[model samples]
Target: MILLDEAARHLKASLKDMDTVVLTPRLSQVYAGINGHADLLVHKLDDSTLAVAAECTDFFKNLGLHYNVMPIEGIASPYPGHVQLNIAVFGKWVIHNMKVTPEPVRAFYERQGYHFIHVAQGYTKCNLVVGRRSLITSDVGIYRTLKDIAPILLVESEHVALKGFNYGFLGGASGLINDTLVFAGSLERHPSYARIVKFLDRQGESWTQLQGPLVDVGTLIQI
Candidate 1:
């Protein structure tokens, strides 16, 4: 099953063939628009385990996936507080601002023998787009931090839409479905369209460009 934000309902037609769950504004702690962002509400620790927020436990109960309900009430609206589960996992390493990460989430990853890569950015998952063997980001801190460890693609963050922010991120606008990268909006509207395509081509990756301007509806989380 795939989890998507309720705000992204317009893209449902394109993805009608797949089973998807739309996240509604149930958590009051964070901004309403972002209440259902999977990266903020749940973290897929591994193939079987998921670290989910307390408020969202009911949503995944019938999904037949093993999940741990976090101790916190919900994700707070403030910067670091809202990013508790917003970590990016690439292969064996997980990246995030370690200082603000929830203790339980951190401990779970550590127990799984995963290495933690620290970055200054709290919204690591939002700012990063992970491929099978490579990574992409617009945040310089994240790019600089992972450049040495992996093949990282640096792109401009302009033109991506977010309800309450200046701009959304590339990671939030796209998700990987098997080997095909699915984008919520058109890639041609972005300044780095050509570069992005070339980078994907080099990695032997194909992409599906949905119609409309790019908007960050968190990420399309497949469970």
Candidate 2:
């Protein structure tokens, strides 16, 4: 199953063969365009477990995946509140502002012995595009923080669109489905398109660019 933003419903035709769960603006606190972002609403604890917001539990209940409803009141529209579940989980390192992350999510990863990298940026997952062998991001703080620890590509943030915001993020616009990287829209319009293609080539990854200009529909959560 894959979780996608309802705003990108037009792309469903391109992904007609896949089982998709479209996230609508059910949560009042988050803005309309971002309310359905899987990175902000869902946390994958393990292969069979997922930590999700209370309002989203019903969506995953029948999918055969065990889910833990976050033990908090609804997410608020403030900076940290909306980012509670937006943690970036890499192979061995999990990056986010641990102080704001929900306890249930943190405890599970801690018990698994994963290294936690704390950054001032709360929306770590939205700012990151996790590839098989490397990482790509537009947030300078994230790039500097993980540069020494991982193979990372820092690209310009220009041209990525997000409604009601100055710009969107690369991570929010794309996701990796095994060896194939899936993008919400076209990368050819991006300023650093060539650099991004080169980075993907180096990682030995293929990609699927859907349609229209690149927009942040949040990371496509594939399970």
In candidate 2, the residue pairs with backbone N, CA or C atoms under 3 Å apart (3 or more residues apart, or in different chains) clash, namely none
Clash count per candidate = 0, 0
Q: After superposition, how far is residue 80 of candidate 1 from its true place, in Å?
A: 1.3
Q: Can you give the TM-score per candidate against the true fold?
A: 0.92, 0.92
lDDT of 1 by residue, 1-223 (tens): 6677887888887765655655534456877667768778878877767777777777667566566444445478867778888889988898999998778888888888999999999889888887776788999999988899988899987679988778899898887765567887999999999999999889877778889999888877777
What lDDT score belongs to each candidate, Candidate 1 first?
A: 0.80, 0.80
Give the runs in model 2 whose Cα sits over 4 Å from its true position: 18-21, 64-74
Tens-digit lDDT string for candidate 2 (30-117)? 7776887788778787776777777767766756655544444466677788888888888989899888988877788889999999
Model 1: clashing residue pairs? none
Candidate 2 local lDDT, residue 21? 51
